[model samples]
Target chain A: MNPKFYRSHVLICTGTGCVSSGSNNIKSRLTAKLEESGLQDEVKVVETGCHGFCEKGPIVIVYPEGVFYCQVEADDINEIVEEHLLKGRVVERLLYTELGTEKKIPAYSEIDFYKKQHRIVLANCGRINPESIKEYIAVGGYEACGKALTEMTPEEVIAEVKKSGLRGRGGAGFPTGLKWEFTRQTPGDKKYVICNADEGDPGAFMDRSLLEGDPHRIIEGMIIAAYAIGADEGYIYVRAEYPLAIRRLEIALEQAREYGFLGENIFGSGFNFDLKIKKGAGAFVCGEETALMASIEGKRGMPRPKPPFPSVSGLWGKPTNINNVETFGNVPDIIRNGADAYRAIGTEKSTGTKVFALTGKINNTGLVEVPMGMTLREIIYDIGGGVSNGGKLKAVQIGGPSGGCIPADLLDLPIDYESLQEAGAMMGSGGMVVMDETTCMVDVARFFLQFTQSESCGKCTPCREGTKRMLEILDRICSGEGREGDLELLEELGDHIVSTSLCQLGGSAPNPVLSTLKYFREEYEAHIKDKRCPANVCAGMSAAYVIDPETCIGCTACTRVCPTGAISGERKQPHVINSQLCISCGACAEKCPVGAIAQG
Target chain B: MKSLEELRKLRAELEKELAARNSEGKPKIIIGMGTCGIAAGAREILQAVLQELEKRNLDVITTQTGCIGMCEQEPLLDVELPGKERITYGKVTPKDVERIIVEHVVNGNVVEDLAIARLEEGGI
Candidate 1:
């Protein structure tokens, strides 16, 4: 062996967030510096996957001494090389300053943001060479599959998963082990396992990141599932929007097949399994398991009623087991590490860590995985680095269209199946969109309702007509034309739609509307009673601009920027905005230089 | 192309080599080369480090890794000098490479100002 060569390893984030921030230039500059200094021989640099802390990227870490450097720029390279690399001194200014304390911490793991996170499904995500099959193998990649094939029987493998209490990471928190068992016990000559990668929620990218960062892990998980369920073929129903994820999945499939872990696999044990990629056309409705299966079958994606859930009969009328990218991603770990180890991490009901695409007003806007029982406040403030812009927290929207908005008052609620359900929200595919005080609650409800309304397949009248009518009421209320009973109508219609719709797409469509009504009813009442939007978010209810004479120089800057000629004033005088002609596009507010514009 | 058994044997050999190195006090240096890291120019820095080590015939091993979430600082370096301390150098450039080797690796003295942080008694 080459005598212990380099003393330290440096990991730089190359995930999507860092790539957009010019991480590549920093890599080249670092290489050039290292070579010139002749430390290239003693030092090593490796670019790894996303390390989850996206708020302060592009991130850099040095380990076995884990020193985290945040928001470093290209010009800072010389100081790092000259002072730290050569003189062994840390640049304190470049260190990540914790929110409450001014003290500079060195190690990456000790940072409060990562201390609470339990990374299981994301174990190898930011740590390994994702593209290198050799590196994956070196880290005991296929060992789980080998063990499953060589040692354990299919029944025993299934039993272990059942004991682990693993649930589907896909929006609906169904039991993964039970789903597999149902497909296994069902009467069918040919069975299949489908991994859903068509993650369509607005703020969700957990599935995409998993596929890109650790494609092999998902593949291995699928293979294990296939072996357990007697599945001969598998399909990864990925969305066409994720080109990077698709490329990685294809590469991973090829590598798995080459290793004999897939495609007539055997560790001297007879079991056959193969996986294929099926791209979705980016329809939000296709995220539904039934519609997703239909899309895979070369049919116009649409949902079919239950009783014969995917486990009983699905995907070309076979006993098919459907699991999302995250669910499949967990299989290998569960198998290799044992069920008890996996179960020991999370709450009694919801076992293991959950991957969340924490976006919107949160400081850390990338993917994060915390244990099941972690409170929303912990996720937002502790793991997510708190709200961005130091804005006051208002509400959080969990579970996308199928879920509801949780108010700030309930921020301390622990995130689990039962707790979130009781709080009028479901952990829908782990999409946590944090909102600040500036966000209008009524507008938030309307936005999600609009999303579901447009994406509805229009198959049943309750969903098709109910969503349309609900959206119209929301629009009227937001536009200040709401009647005295508009709120009652919304609540009544929302319940009707939720109870009468055909599939989950229709059934859960009214969550956003109902949840907002339940929590922010006053905002709705204000639109009708006071003819105003409390947060000044509604386009129709809010006026364009009110000039503050104290600050306005009468430069007519607002008039010039306004698309409409609503502002009238001479040069160097305070302008008067004509509300009759103002469109409330906020152009005048944006163009105001002296901080004279106000909108309400 | 090799048979499955042959591939397995080769994998075993590589594992053995890795295990032996890990057991010894020879600190292993991993370079982030994920898509984010590569896009950030980690490839070039990785090559430079390997070439420099080859020229000096140092008893160090180099490997590529994935992103570590700090994309702003690409081509990052982690130095685990034997018996001393492990330091993370960020925003590294090619011009500063030679000085790192001469000052840190050869002299048994670590460059202070450039380091992002030092791994102390407990892991970071």
Candidate 2:
């Protein structure tokens, strides 16, 4: 008998998802309470990494009796402590209620969200202490590099990747093995492996989280790729915007070098590989492969034409293998586990899981990696926990500015590279922003176009001139000056820009305009024909707020908080908004004591 | 510098620990102390659980886990009983420690209203 020493374990989620939601405070409070109650010595509290089911956070598990709690709040703490801790009674109200059932689940594994997920790349993400190198090593972190260095030849390594059917996750679904083979076969003495960490796509943080949660895994993956391609040096081109990820990566690299996993004849293998970090100056265009390489060379980040693709002649006029943070992160797993094992997860063509930074109007707005064939419905509904604020799902923007908007009708479509492209959207760097019915499609199109227009290098006439013209037209339309031929003019200019642009940045710049036109033509018609923004998102088309006489509670909260001196009324009387002076900032609506304010 | 074989051995050892506890009738409790949980007072609940078990000298093991969704609920706790069902308690407080110990552990009867949900077979 193990002395009958108190038999329960409390597992707390220390993943980024929970951290953002204030899990740290909960941990500290629980610790203080346990110590005060003299219950600290028996049960041990361990802070683990991310659990894939990020929708329900600040999750706590009581062992021996698997009790699962969802949406745990601080105010409800004492009840939990008194009812469950002291009395050894499970707290039923705090239990996670299944969608259709009264059955309260007590274990993490029983949740439907967790059951479907086969976590591979993200296996250790939520399970270990991210800051501790020993914990990473304890989970076979650098073993894949060891296996590749000691056992597999360069060709064999490439062959395994080729067999796995892993594709580039940085927007374009280029085959990873094919890209490596190209660099390997290229006759260049100074081959380089570059990790594209300049994740500038709006609302995308998959790369950042992966680096923050498990930086060593990416390093291990890169080392394997460097060995496979016979590259002597590697560079991680990350944006300066991600200070945390950059710091973590630097630490991880130092740890790897110290452990003999990086730099000079790694793992006793004859192959020597070293990694360097290059900071990007936050240019959106720098996400392009050529621009990323140029930035590393201490030049202004700008895209160059293809045909001298990075694999053949890139980075100081030498052969280079450029894989994004996600692509490299998958390499170690492919080698550690067999390629056949990976190939079994995703669709036949697009094998393995793809990581997405699920954002916008989704309930579970965090990092998610699912098999390639998982439908948008599963991602948005089951994993993302449906549209946020109980709003109707309108559209999903995939692949950032370079990708297109996918309407809700195509929510059931499998989320493979080809399927997304077929639905007029691309898997551009795994940024999936779920938009709701309140979003204005016309406004959405304008926003992305403005981004690309500003980010364009202006090296090409088509993209520079064409994008500017389209943006001007969009601005006019958004400002309620749109004419009947404006939509046609946008399509014509978009086609011209896409056809004649120098590189992918410029080439795919018109995707947002083209896609929004393809799906939400009515919105465009309303903007041009009816001159009204249906979603009330376009500020130019929206009217100022006015208080209804019946609902006004005579509270001066709205009048007091209004930034503009637009509302005028005596106390205890309904206020009338002067439209000329009104800014339509919605401060009055928010400050309204009674629900009297309405905006058109 | 540890070799690949050494790293593999370490991994195997860690995995062994994770798998070893389930062999016994002792129940395992996993506390969600993810970033969200920690922010929501998970640390307090964690300490409370430990102190309670230590005071009673009960044979329960406590481990830390990650987020299980439901961001609205923080400081979540999962309790597994031997030969019986698993229950999750949400919004746990240090003050609730005494009640949990008395009603759940010694009595073998669960506090149903506060229990988040019950676990199915083979569900950890």
Candidate 3:
């Protein structure tokens, strides 16, 4: 039988980032416009997953020609269809221009943001229609599950993963094959595999993107994991906040079941396995294995001490194996291409590519996957297109709230499990948030402390009370109410919290504060002793804006722009800002015509 | 649904459907969709090209182009093959699409009666 074909394939990204930026509207308009042109039969509009260049979202790629149009709006669809699709003339206006240059990148592969990325897990993300099972199959999606089930033994599969040096991408960097082996070694009839999709990091969306973009890859990975661990049932603990991810996963599960990939006798190998998605109530701590398993079992999501790890007792007291979304997303590729192929990409200890959610003060804010040994400078400067607004970079906060801040001097540090840990930051689910020079270090520490403090399950003392104490000190320092030796006191308390914390949360909760203190100690000292914020970020610690009488020119620009009646002077005289009425809002300073305003 | 062979068979069928996007080296059929081409019923020519390709199970990449500045030739179709010169057929109708695919594309023989011009190589 002949298959349907189109002259051109218009791949419009419908991932959450593009969807929020109105890619769906753009897609519908393109489809309607194609029909109007009477070329609907020849032209096909395909909705795929996240292209990862989320900074320039609503991305449209015309295949066969491979013309990449970014930041496309619904209104631009007509021009794209009429000019490019209909006429074959490339749309020059919609092309993505290179950063700091007028050169337009007509092809998607030529974009700097994608040029450095090694997308093993995300290979099918922006390429295929995620909702269609046929598309997934055509891309050799479930072939790994079949290979693992039919060709390789469960022990062989575990050994392959172990040989590949695959680690848990859920921040801990524990060996994934070891965890699977532990579960398989444990004596249990009913074993389970869980994919931890409950990603709650502030700037982390790598897991969510994997789930939304190519969910079947994750499903295929989980099936292989279940077969390895001798499990027939599994659950994916995804947070409720990810509505789009959840919806796509639901569709993938239904489709997989229909194709006999999820139900009994998958691939006719008699390896009966299935999956269920357990929606978390959006607790950050549930990302922990114990807390995740607890939440899945209909209990309050709180972390329990290790030793009786999930491998021995988890999810209604069964030996279970769990991995992160990206970890599972990488499994199928590893199985299909063998352990040696996977081991060849990354560093010795941390093999395969790691997906990072690149965000915050960066020019290209998107999801990027690079090999393990790539330097921070490469990911941030080369791929991220440097800091946004041309601002000088101050630091990069990795591993979310539980991670530490790496100062600008350490930008060349090679990113691997041991290297990041040695630098006081874990590979915490790959949330790399770039901080510019304008960001106050003390405030950043305070912000992370506030997040961990509020999200604390309150079951432990060090996390609940200790985080609060550290937060108070940070708040005092930011608000210009800090006392002498406050920095030393924070260090002492931070050490105590690290020692006394029950779970990983409390143990690593002081990472941001401690690391910032270790690196940017002078910033903390200036905030405390000088009663000033170097970045002018803290409201109470902002330096007073004083008008320089010599340069003020008496233009009354400062007076008119000031919200408060602070600036007062005659039409021809230099303006005098009443210090008492000044809110330190910098309006008068900005409005100074002769460049007279200065922060006193 | 049950066997590995069945899975492979299904995958093979689906891969053909997505071949236009994945295949690299193949014969291409470029239809002029410029304003002039559309007015000259190029839309019908495009539909006919797709139908002829599907009818013969031909693995050809069909794409559209904008105004080639040949308004008098209303509908223009360009066939490009690897290591071959690009043949431009002007004033093409829906009926000529099949013969062009069969005689020129399949048999490797240009229909001189309809062929108007030729470019050496890498002509869009």
Candidate 4:
């Protein structure tokens, strides 16, 4: 044992959010202060992963007291070292205050954002130093891998996973154990296991955080999966955009190799497994399994028909088992603690937890892992602290561009795989973007279609042509040039694309348009019929701005600020805006002294 | 590296290093590290106490405090378990650190030979 102990441990978040906010400087400054105060031996500084309260980044937490500090700057390091680390008095100004209340929360666990979260996948994310494999081992990291390899047979491992009701968390809710069983039972001289860390969904960073925070956990999960499925070689297909995740994963793999966790070894049980990382060139379609396999095989990343699924003929024409990063992250926990323990956490069907990257117009924008079947309301209001800027929530865009928009009326809906699919949204690798009343639903549909349309691999006609057509109609609608029956045309095209597309990329591409049309159809109608955007987001289609003469003070604020010089009035007199010259910029409306602007 | 025993040994070896990071609700051993206490050799006592806890694999929080107006017994050590009254040992040398941790922190028995004062249920 090292036999070294510190009175206090200061864990500074070095996750991407915190690093971008200059946490590295704060860390160095803190180290310098500790050395200056001669408390270097007594106070240990640890760099951790994302704390998930990223809206207040540069988070610092001192253990033995668990004082939670947020938005810490380099200058604040002196106060933390002097007041908290030295004198044992918490710096009151740096504590995380409750969203609506003035009460300061010092402890990390007691915060409302972290209290509602059940962190199984993200258990070690912000708690440990990610760079140290020793810290990972001390937290019981690879014990499950050792247990699976040394004690249990491959059949027993697969049986336990099956009994746990573990499903694939990579958007599709396929049973993971069944996939493993297929790959294990297949006849092949050599087999392969691929971890799909190529998370390409817009607004989703669950896999990146897991890879950056606990790369060893994912590697351990892969080792167990490889042993279960009788695979000797594995590859992690992560996108190249995630440099930090890749670096951490590289470090972890080297450390695991050094510890005999990887390579032809096996606690002397005679099993051989090694992994290599394949970086995808940032293609959204490569997230699909076949496309990912094709990319790994040094071919163009495009999906082929299934039926001869990866379990039968996968990478390099061998039997392969592919699972998502999060799906694999759950394996070690399920094996260590029995299947019943894993099944007990979530609903009967969707067992265990799901990690969602909560973003958009929410008060707390970060990552959150909640148990399956948790209500959207609980995730949005209880954990996310409701919509941002006290705005009314209009809808939530779940599952990325391939997913759908859920209206405010469905806020109480329990978020399970089946329920999300029933609401026309697949639980897409867990991206929950809350939209406020100021958001235009028609534009939201257009935004997602634009993303999917641009990311389409163009392998099939339905996805290529169909998405183009839908996006064109959406474009026309938002630009105030929409014709009647455009909504019906979009629905027909969406159904055709969903039914005829070759891969899931094309199949689910029209989800945003179809789901938004299903829920907020009236908004689309208003765009076409009234020639107006109710939310005033579409600059071309927004209702014309007019000065309310009765309330206009003619303070000349509007006239001086208007770029078009449309407002004409005298001092203390009512102003009149030239409608033709107004341009609907709303600058005059914002600049008006009195409440005198109206959309006419 | 070839067997489960190796992994377990590795885990056991590093477990004590992380014990200090998770010391909520655990018994606390506070060493008076004030200027006067440091002059009386309090830093050595803190090191000895931490080493003993690590050797025995105990979960205890060790902290430092300024002097409490008892410079005569400068190197003071206080042990306060959860819901237990605080026990302070005065004039503590590096040699007495292990016995105090074993008796007061682990076994819940105060060392009578080094008895000094008893505070209320709460800790500083």
Among these predictions, the greatest TM-score belongs to 3
> Could you tell which candidate, 1 or 2, scores higher by TM-score?
1
Tell me the tens digit of each residue's lDDT in model 1 across A1-600: 433345455567777677678777788888899889866855567766777777788887654446788887888777766555543456788898877786787877788877888898888776765776766776777878887877798899999999999998886789988888899999887999999888988778888878877889998898889889999999999999888788877887888777777776456577888889999999988988888898888888888888688888898989899999999888999999999999998899999989988889977777889999989999999888888889989899999888898999998998998888888888888889999988888888889888988999887898988999998988898888999999998889888888887788888889988888899888889999988888878887875567877888998878888888989988987789888888788888888877788874
lDDT of 3 by residue, B9-112 (tens): 88888988777675468898888887788889987898888888888888888888777788798799999887899999999989999899999899999999
Judge candidate 2 at residue A362 and give its lDDT: 81
> In terms of lDDT, which candidate is stronger, 2 or 3?
3
CA lDDT, candidate 4, residue A394: 96
Q: Please give, for residues A493-582, the per-residue lDDT of candidate 3 as tens digits.
A: 899998987788888899999999999999999998889898988985877788787787898888888888888899988778887787
- What is every candidate's alpha-carbon RMSD to the true fold? 8.4, 9.3, 2.0, 2.5
Ranking by DockQ: 3, 4, 2, 1
The 0-to-1 C-alpha lDDT of every candidate, in the order given, reads 0.79, 0.80, 0.89, 0.90
lDDT of 2 by residue, A1-600 (tens): 123344445666766667777778778887877788666765556565666456677777665455667677666566665556644557888887766466787766686566666677777775555665766876777878899999999999999999999999898999999999999999978899999998988877788777777888888888888888889999998888777678777887888787777878677777788899988899988888998899889898888889899889999989999998889889888998989988999999999998887889987666778999999999888878788888999999999999999999998999999998888889988888899989999888889988989999889999998999999999998888899899999999999999999888889999999999999999988988887788988875777678898999778887788777778888888778888787777889988866789884
Candidate 4 off by > 4 Å: A550-555, A569-574, B31-58, B64-76, B89-99, B112-124
Question: What does the lDDT read for residue A559 in candidate 1?
Answer: 83
Provide chain B's TM-score, model 2: 0.75
State the lDDT at A365 in candidate 4.
95
Worst 10 residues of 3 chain A by lDDT: A585-594
lDDT of 2 at A492: 96
What does the lDDT read for residue A569 in candidate 3? 93
Model 2 residue B7 CA deviation in Å = 2.9
For candidate 4, state the interface root-mean-square deviation in angstroms to 1 decimal: 2.8
